[model samples]
Target: MSNNLALNIEKIKKEKSGIDVLADIYFHAVFGEKISPENLERFKWYGIYAQDEQQNYFSIKIPLNMGELNLIQLKTLSLISKQFSDDSLIFSNEQKIEFKNIKIFDLPKIFKLLQEVNLNTFFEAGHTVRRVLTCPVNGIDKTQLIDVEPLANKLNETFIGNKKFENLPNKLQIAISGYEEGCDVQFTPDVSFNAIKDSKEKILFNVKILGNSIGFISPSQVLKTAIAIANIYKDFGERDDVEKSSFEYLVKNLGLIRFYDILNSTINYKIQQSSFKNEISHPRKPRLGINESKIEGQSYIGCKIYDRVVQSSKLDNLSSLLEKYEANRVKLTHKGNIIILDVPTLNAQNLACELEKISFNPFV
Candidate 1:
């Protein structure tokens, strides 16, 4: 470990209370900075804490809204990597980054980097769209309703620029997937949409509200058609409290009738109940299997990313491999998985073997 990290750990242990030692240590390690006593007190208001293990290792539980550590911040993280253990920068399941191993002396430098880099631009408060994750495969799926990427981008742009939406009391999440197999795990979001085939064979988007993560997991009947539903949440969503600021809470507080009334008024599209048979299913379940996509003849393999935090260099290397191997296309699944498509079937086994060498095991 770097002397900077060692000194940071010791200083945190000495100066901060048991609950704050982790955040103070992490802030220094990653940004080379420290939180003031007052800010630390504020963090406590959110129930964040520092935890220590038998190995004397410590970590901080960060909220989800703090998701925007950009490319510049990532470059700065390279400095942290050099000065600390490789495991020091850990990404949580919710996509939050945790920095381990920091020193008090490094605090000023970390603060300088935070200020210089303006890291606050990336941080979101409660129930904002910061945690609204999506699969790159959203619109490209062979079976999907209207392309949702445009809508998703619009939501992101609106949230980032619209100060009116920022001070909501809580965080909100939204997910859209066009596949029936539920590959994108849309149900896990605060508000979710899944594309389904209607009786007429036309594709219609099903809106699921308060589906998961805030107490309600029941797959409600399609709340409204896709475009209208999106507009509804975009216009009338609540952010009253970060903890209770999910679509579920909104639906609970204002019954679906009133909610749809608000939604119908805001959107131009008709609010029609979906004619499709609603398959009550969990969204996060895996859709791919040996029988799903015929892979016996393909050279390239699909690899499931545990979290979407692979290094940029690794992505570049994968691209290079695709070019070298003449793999012409890459597919991103809603499940946060990547598919390197279109390789000679004869070479598939060899390619899979090579990928496993890099810790990417094909789903057998």
Candidate 2:
């Protein structure tokens, strides 16, 4: 097959940006109008997917900003699941939330519920950058060297729904972590940033392409570097084969040297060559059970979620417990465990015991 030929998906994207399909969504979901097949495919941009050939049921994905949710946000999600879904939520490896078995008519209502908590489904799927992943314990982990939570949140905010990135050749996954040792990491994203200290003891990011270190970049250049990468991908990525159109595939085909050259030229800046002496230590045991947070006299509970499924009733119970314990927030880990953060040391044991009773099971 000729790689020069454009695929139908590319053609579909050219016809309209996926992010502009909200009106069609309202027409179909609110007015009960029949959806065209193209519009059905376009719904993915907003994280809505048909569950059956009849297109009567859907599953929606909600990407969390660094997967951190406050008490009210968590409770709102629980209430939405109880009201609109089949009483369950599926947490993905990317730290996004999913609701299954939703009727077509209930999607807008669910989205409205999400809006109350300042969450949105836009750019949650489609051919743009997916959720920007980061260390679950970004600011809270005792081992963190540099707090990447603010940087990650800024990156996520800058890209999602941006008109320029709406129609990429394929989806991109990016992960950043401030963990000094990169411990217990489950997977490598298309682009990754691992915190490193230079010989001068200054914090910098060791950037990698598809798991191989490309070079180092300063904290300020992260957003610009990401934009350059996306621009290069949009311009030169293969569009003939949907299955082979990933940014990783493009990098592999072009070879690192050529891809790095293009990235360097596109960004119009010098990237430190991959000659740094920083080493990425191999991952260790996952952060399971209760652990001390970065703050003295405060702790977090790491509750292992089996199969990434949680009943809404259990989530409601978890939310109530957060209020009772006055925990600061909840973070969904890339490993699919739920970490209840910022509980006082005095209340940690009681909170862990209550969480275990609901099958959150911190002992595992």
Candidate 3:
């Protein structure tokens, strides 16, 4: 980090692309492919969960868009948990899956296996744009006004693989949601867009920077606005200290209005000041319960689990229960709860009891 190679500590893996090298590492180990110090450091960028704190073993943080997980992916996670990390799939507060206690040599096989189910551990950590989070309820809940899944996915696609953004000053946390009441850790992100109404009552997102309301942008313009704000961060965010160069520090030092105007200037349009006024505070609502979907006769059963600790066997059991009860999908909540979506009304209590057997009681 102190060398003349790169000023930023986050973007030092230049010998080969991180993802490609992971594949190479997996296949070339017999030919003396060894993990360099820099390669090991860069692994976190792709959600490779090796940590100085955890030591030797690693964890892969697989992101879930709106915490959405189909049955196939759930089975994949169960397999990863059962084979690699004991029997637990730890749920991150960001609505992602963490596969823990994995050996370094087994990563390529694991990554290849996850790819079969259309999942990859990409950009879940480091200075890059981390995971894109949205309302967990999404299309399932009556409380949600617009399903921002598309927007979240679009943002994910726009930011995750882009090398230009890989070396920003520090981690740039972002959240986009259509939840009127505000879900998904709204205020804590570096940039947050929460859906709201204008004077005409049309749904538009009120943009907030560092938890302070800046202005509003239309739904179609959300992506544009996101890119603009990101560019502003890349351009103006301080990089000297690295530790103090996070988006929050940039906002704090530059002041809110200064950063707001910078964002507006970058996008080449004025952000209309929003008339809407409300501060959301529920970090852990809808944590455990039978949530009725926006569609009648369907319900989502949510269960509270440890934020960072999970038994691999219990997760395998959870996947089996989902299969047994005919649930189509599961979503992870920001509060570290798991939501089994598309359940019939008749099967709701049964799902709860089954989860209870695994000690993840939905009722409690």
RMSD over all Cα atoms, model 3:
3.1
Better of 1 and 2 by lDDT: 2
User: Candidate 3, residues 1-364: lDDT per residue as tens digits?
Assistant: 5554335354564455454445544553335444556666577677874455434677788877667889888777777877777777677778878877777777777878889998877777766777677776777777666878888888988988688777677778888777654564524777788887767879899787766677778898888998887888888887766667788888788887777667777776779874333455553255467877787888888777754577756666777887788788888778677778788888888888878878776876
Off by over 4 Å in 1: 1-125, 136-147, 184-187, 197-202, 212-246, 274-279, 282-300, 304-349
* lDDT order of candidates, top first: 2, 3, 1
Any runs in candidate 3 off by more than 4 Å, and if so which?
1-24, 27-34, 49-56, 184-187, 274-284, 306-308
TM-score ranking, best first: 2, 3, 1
TM-score of each: 0.55, 0.93, 0.88
**What are the per-residue Cα lDDT tens digits for candidate 2 across 43-81?**
899998888878778899888888888988888888888
Q: What RMSD, rounded to one decimal, does every model reach?
A: 10.3, 2.8, 3.1
- Residues 1-364 of candidate 1 have per-residue lDDT tens digits of 3334322332432343333344554564566444543334333322232333221332333322213333345555445534542433444444344455444444445445645755322223322344345444343333344455555555555554244443333445666555543444433566665556667766655565554211111122232233344445545555333344455666667775666567566645544643223346644333232112233444435666664554544544554555556555544444445555566665556665665556445654
TM-score of 2: 0.93
Q: What is the C-alpha lDDT of each candidate?
A: 0.45, 0.81, 0.74
Model 2 lDDT-worst window of ten: 276-285
